[model samples]
Target chain A: MNLHGTPLSIVIFALFVAAVLFLSFFFARKAKSAAGYYAAGGQIHWAVNGISFAGDYLSAASFLGICGMIATLGYDGFLYSIGYLAGWVVALFVVAEPMKRMGKFTFTDALDAKFDSRGIKLAAAISTLVVSICYLIPQMNGAGSLVEPLLGLPHWVGVILVGAIVIVIVSAAGMTSTTYVQFLKGGLLLIFSTILVGFVLSRGLSTEPVGLESGAPRGEMTVQATDSQLLEQGYALLHTTGSLQKYVRDGTTTWWKREADGTLWRAQWTSDGVVNGVAGGVLEPVGRLRQIGGMSEAEAAAGTGSVGPLDFLAHLTHPETRIEQWQKQAVTDEKGAKYAVYTPKMVSGTDQMKPGVKFKVHTTTEKLNFVSLMMALFFGTAALPHILIRYYTVPSPACARKSTIVAIASIGFFYVLTLFMGLGAAVNGTVNPADNNMSAPLLAMSFGGVLFAIISAIAFATVLGTVAGLIVAASGAVAHDLMDRFGRMDLSDRQKVRAGKIAAFAVGIVAIVLGIVFRGVNVSFLVGWAFAVAASANLPAILMLLFWPRTTAAGIVASIIVGIVSSLGIILTGPEMFAGPYGLTAEQAWHPLGQPGIISIPLSFLALIVVSLVTKNRRVAVEA
Target chain B: MLHGPARSSGPDPASGYKTRLGVVMFIIYCVVYAGFVMTNVVNEGRAMQTIVFAGLNLAVVYGFGLIIFALVLALIYNHLCTRKERELNVTRSEKGAGA
Candidate 1:
């Protein structure tokens, strides 16, 4: 469902963004001190801070990616939500009060609290930047993806816009502005999502899903020798037009054409008037009913024979169910013809299982890699520099605890509503098969133009809120952790605050550039890497400091370094990164797998213990 | 100074009662965690399985986890609050005697 650029949505979105910016500027005046810039002068109300936690926590990936995944993959997408919420458990029980007590500013404050070690400060700062950048890439990308459809701007322009606005917000008031922005966005996100979910349930499950097409179906045709040797030998001219868009030498391509009336149809490649199969046979476009075993009454009642409500729900929740949807082409030739491929994969069930179901196949095996990725997200929340720093914005540790509980309630309710909204998108048949990021927007389109506009605008605010928070966190690390803490710069409060604002601008620009560069990758997938890195590099250190008596400064420093290196090394050298970008074959990648949480987390813990023990007596004598 | 007063009431039976409560809550948490894991494994990670008691499954799994978390937090807070109360009482009585 393509949005018609409705005036209502534009106005709503404009007002929302303008209000956020205005509020940020208002707060900027109040944030002259370093304390105000980095920690909101320790004056934000617990309730507001709690909601801001939801706002900061629920990024574009959570709202759009997870919702889209649920729309396409079913229960698997919800796994992200569950995993995300579960991480708060770690935050509430293990990290909250202590983090507030230990750290004065950034996550590095807590890590370097016991040691006062420069190594720990530097390592933690670097990890914070890396994870923040990784996390920023997806948010920026989501911003671009959102803008292209909403404002009809180029992807790069969207990235720049989000980057600029977020920088302005961060630079203006730092955490003070960021927190309020987040609180506003978080409240709006929940409120709007609740409204959207209400609309979804009212629509209910239809017998036949209706009105999903938004473009023309063009047939593209391509021919290449099936022989791998021949394909590698030379350039192969492949004819691709109509439904069979392109025949590629190396990869499979797929495409959909929109009819004049906006009825979207899939283009089928045919030989002898039959669709071509891998085995050289005709393939036909199977109607929805035939694909899911002739629709039942539930499907009929919904006026769509494609998929029944129960069946659709079942397919989503079932781990073994393989659902097919169109995805954008990864690589295309110089021709204007876009390439698409049809790939089949099993659904993820990890989202459906409650936390502590770690032993399930979904949680344990490589097939359920997304689950493992989510496990990192779940645990990573407490360790996030941005989030941990937010704890310090409150005056007392008790207030920190109170704020977390409030955040839990707010965040939890929103996640529950996401299920309804996602499932609604699935049955509404308004999903953008090519881009899951547009699921909520498209679902809003199903309701009406105004609803679509409102939801889309709200989603834009979501990006703004999160990006502001991240920029604030990154700025704090640079100005406070690096300069003041390590560099021994004797800057006044005003200078520190000014330096932080400058850092925020620089980080914002970098985020925008990275966002534009990584457009094709799934936002949620990218976020998973961020979570893994955060969990690996930060969680172990935090846990050890809070729980262990023997944790010394040297130990903390060593653990931070080991955790950062091992996680980054594993990710960079892992099959996914090396094979995709580094021009290395999958086999040539050094790591056995992509995820490093399972290994790096443990390694960090061990490194801390061993190093702390070895250096314990040495440190004692020095202090004496 | 804080510990000196707390030492007088430290051996109260209430401590034993609280420990038992802690043990029970811990066991409940373990059971709920195990049951959730078992459900996922047995169902092979399928959704919407009609377990015998209908809504009971959701109630048990979600309720148990939440209750455990809440209980743990409450226990910790209670312990801290009581200690503070005792300290405040001791400090007030000492001031009264000096007056």
Candidate 2:
């Protein structure tokens, strides 16, 4: 759906960008030293650092993608929220303290803190670069999408705008500026989402929702007509396959499903406002209730006046409540021209609240894929390069632990709100079936235009905060690990900060290009792959280094290399990638698993052990 | 030439206690999380649809439970570790000052 840029949204977006730039410039003076640039001088209070973690982690994917997924697929999206928040458990329990005590600047520093080997530095730095770049693609893409509705600009313009703004943020002050921006964004996101959920609760559930009446306009004309009558009104029969017939008139396509009695029922896009032979208004905006608590149609029209949080979920999940769900089907005409058409089906509230709708886990491969995704999400948190680097921004191991706890409390609360916001959008007739990404924004618009503007601006800030964090991680990899440590350049602190700034600019440009190039791909899928890569590559190395005393420099290097190669190899050849950019059938792909974590994670651990044993014996022989 | 300068050489006094506590908490979470994934996988979410508690199905109840549980565990873990660090490290520091 094409979204128009309102004057209010533009003003809010401009103010948000202006504040971010102002923060960047303000902090520039303090970031002249390498330590200050990379880690905010390791003096950020635990509370601010904690919320910044949430800001950095809750990328566009968490807000837009999860809300969109939940808005459409129900419980499946919350599965992501659960997995994502669970990953922090690993971060707090396993990686947080050790990473803080050991590392000085970047993720590589923590890994090489013990062995200090050039090989570990090089391997870890390269992995950080690769992972950061992969993660950057989705954030950049989300920025572009947001810009279209906010500023009425093209996607590339949005990509370039975010890129330029983030480059300035990273180069000007680095972590200091990045932290404050994230803290602000994280705080606003939580506050406004709570307010929006309040609006949802106040408005409550309604069977006969006002705005888009059952996705069809109210009191519109309708008449049952024969096939002859439909054709007489200039509806061309596009194709007839099985019980479904496709038709087109004036570039508007519609579907007709034949009933058992041989009568045809039509479902078409409502915006076209085409009604001939079919009803004039039956194809309305969807996502309203058919019935609540077994009420009659007349009684249900009264709607639930207002509900508390628990009451909303209880009523929505009642078995007697029927929700209008829109399912999209890919249809092809006689000419083989293909497009998607939405058809409405009534689903029980209980069924919508369950898991089977999105992920069909009956097949063994599908079940394994589901489990693999959860594993990646569970282990992926502590291993993420950006998240790992956040540890160094705190003063001590104790502070790291405390900050992680703060992050968990705030993020968990916000995730619970996602369920309400998503269901609110689902039942309020606000979800745009064509692009579920617009669900949250549209839901906000349902409350009022001002709330919509603030939410959009916050969503835009969400993108900026995450992208800046990624760039900071990527640049630290280049300047600190690769250039200074691995290459042994021995640069001064001033020169090191300058190198990082330059690297930030270079990485930002690359992110912008990739974002525009991969515009139409699913943002969540890319993010999932990033997590898988992080879990497979970084987790094993970090874990073994901290816990395993015999872990050698060679082992860490070997594990990092194996982790990066295996995960990337699997993902590039996996089913999703094959079905997507490669333009091939999913079954034709080499890999069976959609996620690489289950296999690659273990492979990395094994590589570390085997390499360490062999290297240990070799060192003994050399000494003799 | 293979080794770079290490930041700190001696083992930390609180390291042993903290690692043990962290590992235990990590294992507990992993087991609970695995159960959630397995429940959906085994019966094709049939178990998830069954109303488990509070008039909510097993899916809604368990999914929200996992999120809230993680935070609670985190808070508990942080509190315990902080207490241990104070108890263990303060004694070591006092001994060091005497030496």
Candidate 3:
């Protein structure tokens, strides 16, 4: 897709940034004390805090990444939605009230509440910093990419700009400004997504592709030719004959499918430089509805106008409905130059509603990987330092519980909308084959330019809100937990708040550098790694501390250290990293599994148990 | 009895009751979530495609059900816990008045 920011988009985005900065400066006076700076003076209303939770938690990954995944891969994307929501069950039920009651400012305070051991303080602080940094990398990188197509800026400029803005937001009024910013972002995101989904349901489905939906004529045609005939025509066959075939000639790669009559029907990429399709006259856009509820192209176009929620889902789930999914192919030309092409594959609606499209459960390793990822996502939320610190932002444990309930309601509602938005992108000719992350925004574009601008601005604000939260968590770790507690700096209240501001600046700079350095890395993958690390390193210790009376200080420390080291070690040495960033073959990696939560989480629990048992004689203050 | 200053010296009486209820709720949710994961794993997601309700497949129904169920459960838990906290505080205040 050729995307250049319209003048209208730039104005809206600038207004959004200005509004956020205004809020920061407005709230600056309220953050005079350390508590005010770190936890918004613990005076946030449960309702506002709840929405802020959604804003803080739903990063660019949830808005762009999941919608993109769902648009491309179907129901497998919703699996992320399910796992992420399930995690809140842990957060609300197990962690929220206890964390609020025990901690004053940071997650480390809660973990070290029972035991005043410096080891616990140091270990928890390190874990917080590690997880916060890992999570920040993806949010920062998402900012850069969102700015590129939304503002027409370069990658580095976007990263630095987001970093500077977030630092100001965090330093100016700390949690007070951050919370309001997130609340605004959350409200706008929900309102706009609901509107977009309403638009989608009203439009319904169409059998015709881009021309009917997007007003762009599709380019496709079928030429009857055998494999040998194609070879005679100077086309080099790349792969063949399942539902799709691939061939490359000159600088263009063409896609083919075998017809029932033993002939090949091909679609070629045009010379428009935007990955448009042009091959004879039968080709269409990369993604569209082929048939809806068994209706043919012309029939469905005339019949299926405007549908309700259940009716829309029912039509999509019909066995006769077929949605065109674009499968991307990475192929090399005759001179070995790499090129990406998309092939249209017609998938049955039933299969589209199933889980096998993206995550395959056929092999033993695949099953383990799927299970591991689910485990990470399910256990990760409560363990995250940013999420944990939010508990302290409320006045009482009951307020924390209420805030969490609100968060679950709003966030859960948003996840449900993602299903419709993703499916809308798929069948409405809005999927960008080159960058799946653009699916939701492009779908808004299909509605209107104004809607697109508003959605893009909300998406960018989503990055800002999440990044501000991360920097706060990292700063709290450095200033409150490590320097104040572990190092016994005995900082005054003013000094502590000033130290936190300085730390926020430092973390923001680091995030900016890392975001630019990892420019092309997938944001979702980085987020998944952060979840694995958080679940492994923090969840076990927190759970045991809350439940197990025999849990000693040494046990918590060991569990955290082991959790961090093991998960990071496995992820760094795993096959995926080896193949992707390390420039080595997957076989060269020592580790087999890509996800670490399955093993590391259990190992962390085991370590805590064994160490606590061994140190039972010297246990720290046991709960009465 | 402790090494350093803490927010409180010992666990409050109400926390024990709340913790028990929270743990039970967590385990209940875990069982259902684990079942969803196992269904996808054991049969290559074939069971997920079975039509369960309202012409929707099991995957969509179950996925949407999980999201809604979480919110419902959270609201229920909050209501129950809030009532319990109020009851305990009222009793404690009454006893203090008598003393």
Is 1 or 2 the stronger prediction by TM-score?
2
lDDT of each: 0.66, 0.83, 0.85
- lDDT for model 1 comes to 0.66
Candidate 3 chain A, run of 10 with poorest lDDT:
A213-222
lDDT, residue A257, candidate 3: 65
Chain A TM-score of model 2 versus the true structure? 0.92
Of models 1 and 3, which has the larger TM-score?
Answer: 3
Q: What is the C-alpha lDDT profile of model 1 across B1-99, one tens digit per residue? A: 000110011223233333344345435544544454344444454432432232223422343344345445544644654565467668777987999
TM-score chain B for all models.
Answer: 0.41, 0.82, 0.85
Model 3 per-residue lDDT tens digits across residues A1-624 = 345688999999999999999999999998998888999988899999999999999999899989988998999999999999899999999999888877888988888888888999999999998998889998899899999988999989999999999999999999999999999999999999999999888877776533233533222322457788878988888764355567877755676766666677654443334343343222243466778876776888665778888788888888888887777665554555454555666788999989998789899988998999999999998899998888878777888899999999999999999999999888877776656787888888877788989999999999999999999999999998988899999899899999999999999999999999989875567788889989999999999998888899999998999999999999999988998888889999996789999999999999999998998898977673
Q: What lDDT score is found at residue A305 in candidate 1?
A: 32
DockQ of each: 0.12, 0.51, 0.52
Candidate 1 ranges beyond 4 A from true positions: A209-299, A302-338, A342-371, A521-523, A582-588, A620-624, B1-99
lDDT of 3: 0.85
Query: What TM-score should be assigned to candidate 3?
Result: 0.93
List, residue by residue over A1-624, the lDDT tens digit for candidate 2.
224678988999889899999999999998988878998988888999999999999998889888888888888888899999999999999888888877888989878776667898999999999889888999999999989878889999999999999999999999999999999999999999999999889888777655443222231111234688789999888788666687778876667766566666565443334332243333343466778865677767877778888778877788988876767766665777564566556688888898888787989888988888899999988899998888878777788889999999988888998899889888887776666776788788776778889999999988999999999999999988988888898888798999999999999999999999989876568788789889999999988887776778888889999999998888888998888778898999997878888889999999999999888853221100
DockQ of 2: 0.51
Per-residue C-alpha lDDT of model 1 across residues A138-166, encoded as one tens digit per residue: 89988988888688788899899999988
Docking class of 1: incorrect
Order the candidates by lDDT, highest first — what do you get? 3, 2, 1
